[model samples]
Target: MPDRAPQPVDRQLPTDEARDLISLVRDIAQHEIAQKAAEEEDAGRFPREVFTLMSRSGLLGLPYDSEYGGGDQPYEVYLQVLEELAAARLTVGLGLSVHTLAAYGLAAYGTKEQQTEHLPAMLGGGLLGAYALSEPASGSDAASLRTKAVRDGDDWVITGTKAWITHGGIADFYTVMARTGAEGPRGITAFLVPGDAEGLSAAAPEKKMGLKGSPTAQIHLDGVRVSDDRRLGEEGQGFAIALSALDSGRLGIAACAVGLAQAALDEAVAYATDRQQFGRPIADFQGLRFMLADMATQIEAGRALYLAAARLRDAGRPFARQAAMAKLFCTDTAMKVTTDAVQVLGGYGYTADFPAERYMREAKVLQIVEGTNQIQRMVIARHVAGPETR
Candidate 1:
């Protein structure tokens, strides 16, 4: 049976403008993204043009200030837009999330002159971005990263390797964190390096189980130099900036998880209603019906949790705990729900002919990115029960 169009989510948008924005996003997702998702992913093709279109449409800077060519929308609205795009394609959604994260250091900490000169192009001028924090030896222990930047006359020469960088080779710029002083987090500083910098290069993209359309690679900064003006915040401040960005970036991951789960649920439901057993639709079976119910409940709950966190951020409240909780819950939900979705389709779900298997593979990454679920638990525990004795 032919697949049916997935139903639109009923969202409680704060304003008419937000509602229209979602509607526009849905239209773009359905027409431009969803149709190509499966095919491109299968071929491991990144949709660079789609990102350019998003940049042109102002989707690239939804939560930033309008003064610098951003949409100036609140986090609540921005995250929902992420959810919608993710429902269509995770590469696009998570790519945008990584882009926002890459832009965070400068947007939140750069000098006024830096913002005026670079923010406009970064936000809306068709430039893509990557964040550089993780390294070959330091993934979760980001503070232990070995990348180093040395101050020259008027430039900082950075030398190191960054691993698992999204859009690694293709990005127009990178927000890099490197050691500049004593060891640990206090030694780190952030710099914005242009992709075309003479010494910047990327290794081949990783061969991943899913989200193949999104490039992940090792970015090499062999004496890559940038003017001192590209430094974000003061020296010894990059770790704090990275943490602040992750607090929000976690919410983005949460939203993407929910959207991926929603897509899986939608696929399962459509298949169940059409496939027959004992001359009746498989969806009518009590066991299968219960599974669908649980999947739907989890997706809805995940959506609500992420949105709540987003609202806290929008209101300027302390939401790091909530964000951690949301990321932990939503990603777990995605993994479970997508797995259940595959079970619903029985034999067919295991095959590449359907997207259930793809969804399952994609769902696994959410639990690992933007701070692993294990890290999320640690973050939450630190907030709730206080830091562990060491």
Candidate 2:
């Protein structure tokens, strides 16, 4: 397992369940995912084999209904699994989380027929999914999206661009947000666009600072036509659905952030104890030990926050603000922990010879993606401001 402290029994979840999931994820991480993480990351290659193995192990659908090939696990259980995967490798964890977010639209809003038609493949991981919300002109302010989908007889012609899409070129389907009514948020609609559809092509992958193994691209919809059957919810409900999906998606990012922080802390601790300086291990130095202590403390706190928010969700309570708080706190902690991890390794940390450098690079994207830390602060501020200001 990760170098994380024991799960407090009083935490907002069943201790045994959390332990079981942690064990399962740890098994996958150590024996399977961890070995190839560094290699594929260096080669800038996606771990399709790892993803396939996860799918076979039923890790892909951790929190969905069993009727549709899902695990029927609670969100609390699901997030821990995500945490473990991320500790092993950020790319796979983030990809799986995004895939689950994309699946939410279909699971939550799709019609019975639509769910029946698509849920099996989606939950089974036979079809990889991506979400298309951010546009070149509109990112954090997603309501300003300009992507258009005009109705024409039995089909809708979708034409616009979606930016910073995870799994853009690789996914079999995309959950796309496009404008269908008049201008502004009220006009937007969501559609399930197949990769094989005409006029739907992804631009070459963006060269990123990290998570390079997970493809990120700009998706172009040039007069792509789709039947109304693919529509998720009513025409103008896209923004709401998107926001709702983000609530859960933020938890996934929070889990990933926590995992990344834990990995950094573990690596730093190991290196500190092993690398000797002045004929003694540097871990014995009070200064370095203090930094390790802080990293471990922050990770544990972040984990608690995210787990609390997840339990709130599982209990059917209002947790949007809490989720945002966890996302913001956890991601920021990841950046700090990973940066210090590099510091722990000193010269070695700066080079590719160690995982600390890669962790530092990967930590940056966690702060930027999934509703940047700035946006997360705004989200939290709204809660403090109350509904009148909101």
Candidate 3:
């Protein structure tokens, strides 16, 4: 007799609002998003239609206020929605989350006047966004970026290259961090650059191993002129705003990793029960059953970590360390779980016939991007031991 299929981890609802949001997200995931995920991923095609549907449904701005045309939902609710989307399609989920992060500088740190000017379009369904921070010379050491934004009377002329931009050419707006003063992080400042700005162009989308449907490319800004009114925050505040945005963004990635792991685990459990080997279902074997147990356990822990961090943030507490820990653990677990999922499928798992292979590929990227697991560890360790100790 085959072992029972693994059950979903118990979800602790943070609020009634979160529960309702999950139901809606799950419905959309099953009925709409899941339909084209496999085909689009295989063809390396972007899911523009899916994004349109998401935008129309108001999911694209869940964490923003309704006055700004947003859903006014809590981060907890927003993250669950992200999890459901990621379970169906990682590329779309990640792109949406990163877009939200790009909008954070304007939402959180932008002056009232700036927010009044930009938040409407940013939260509206039609606009898309990207963050311009990383560069060819600067990835982890973001302050080392060479992009320059020089002030000349009423306007600032930005001339530099932004690498690993998520939306790239597709975004309607970009939050760019460029040097305005000296050489260090404090000299950096953030600006909102419209996609159609003159002298701004995107390179060809990178050929990544996974998340290919979500275009990632370098953006070149050459003598692009914009009014000083476009600046997001005071001079030297760019690094602070970018780091704060990343703290929340890491939680989004953690949620995404959990969703991916859950999907892989579900596929593995379904396959193990149905697959026959040596006159018995593979799930009947204790060895395979234990592996499923481990996968499920790690997924539960991962979700709990992110949930804890989300709660901390909602309660107005310091959650940077918690978010880092969650991001590190969840992404690493995703890598391991998806690999085991392929092992569970045996030969069929290794092929495109099943999603486990693609899932494994997608999981690896999560561990690398949005601050590598190594960077996450450094963050956690620095917090654990004070700055002076480090």
Candidate 4:
């Protein structure tokens, strides 16, 4: 089936420029991205050209400083852009989010010299990035990561493996976290490692249920040497950097979830109205109509939740708890809405001939990525009920 134009979203944009930005994104998404999304996703082919076009069009660096070639748009605006892109292709929307997360360590923690040297190229020069923090043995307990970095003269030698890395093998640069001091959060330090560094290699990409077009692989750093100049922050501060990035990254994930759910709802609505049953549209049935209303409501609520968190983040206040809530609520909404969409489509939804199943599969990972929904609950509970004491 040919991909149709996305259903228009009544966005509450902050400014006239923001409105223009969303319109431009919709144009690119409908004309360039949505048309090929299904074909490329089914073929498991990465649309690198699309990313390059977005880079040139100034979409990749929307939330960062324009002094370094970013769009300088607020998180609210940037996230809405992600929503539009994700409705077209999850790989592209989520890829940009990961890239932004990868850039966060350096952009926020690095010295002036480092920012001046790297941010421009990373933001606008079409250089792709990857974040390397998750290890095979340390998924939830990220601070326990065994990736080691030891000081050797003016350089640091990095050795260990990073698993489930998005854009692992293809990134131009990596924002890597490695143990530098003791075996705890304070021991970790972040580094900006060149992709072509010696002794760095990637394993084969994982075969995934969805978002097959995006590569997820394990990266091995076998005594790869990095200079002190590339360190992101003070030694023993990588965990803090990672957490900070994730707060914003969660918002990105939330926005993407809302987008996916919106797409599924749009699909279901289109199908319900057009697919006739007993000479009347299924949309006339109260049960199906209620389901559609609930889906739309959930999508809107998810969108509002993420935007509220983004506003808090932009205002520079305490928003970790809110971010966690947004992640949990938005992703859960995506899962439910997509599944209901399949249900609305009946047997046809389960088939590859329709994109409903793909949306459901993709939504599964949103609950798992950035931080699992279970982890988000933990985070929120800490804020509300205090940290658990064993």
TM-score: which candidate is best? 4
lDDT of 3 by residue, 144-193 (tens): 99999999999999999999999888888999999998889999999999
| Residue 25's lDDT in candidate 1 | 92
Which lDDT tens digits does candidate 1 get at residues 1-390? 222244599999999999999998998898898888888999999999999999999999999989998999999999999999998999999999999999889899999999999999989999999999999999999999999999999999999999999999999999999999999999999999999999999999999989999999999999998999999999999999999999999999999999899999999998999998899999999999999999999998988899899989999999999999999999999999999999999999999888899999999999998899999999999999999998
TM-score for each prediction? 0.99, 0.95, 0.96, 0.99
Which window of ten consecutive residues has the lowest lDDT sum in model 3?
Answer: 1-10
Error of 2 at 146 (Å): 0.9
**TM-score of decoy 2:** 0.95
Predict model 4's lDDT versus the native: 0.94
List ranges where model 3 is wrong by over 4 Å: 1-10, 388-390
| Candidate 2: clashing residue pairs, number | 0
Count backbone clashes in candidate 1: 0
Please give the lDDT score for candidate 1. Answer: 0.93
Which residue pairs in candidate 3 have backbone atoms (N, alpha carbon, C) closer than 3 angstroms, thus clashing? none
Residue 143 deviation, candidate 4, in Å?
Answer: 0.8
Best-to-worst ranking by TM-score: 4, 1, 3, 2
lDDT of 2 by residue, 175-265 (tens): 9999999878899999999988999998999998888899999999999999999999999999999999999999999999998888888
Error of 1 at 372 (Å): 0.7
Local lDDT at 380 for model 2:
91
lDDT string for model 4 (234-335, tens) is 999999999999999999999999999999999999999999998999999999999999999999999989999999989998889999999999999999
| Reference-based lDDT, each prediction | 0.93, 0.88, 0.87, 0.94
Worst 10 residues of 1 by lDDT: 1-10
**How much is 121 displaced in model 3, in angstroms?**
1.8
For candidate 1, give the lDDT of residue 334. 95
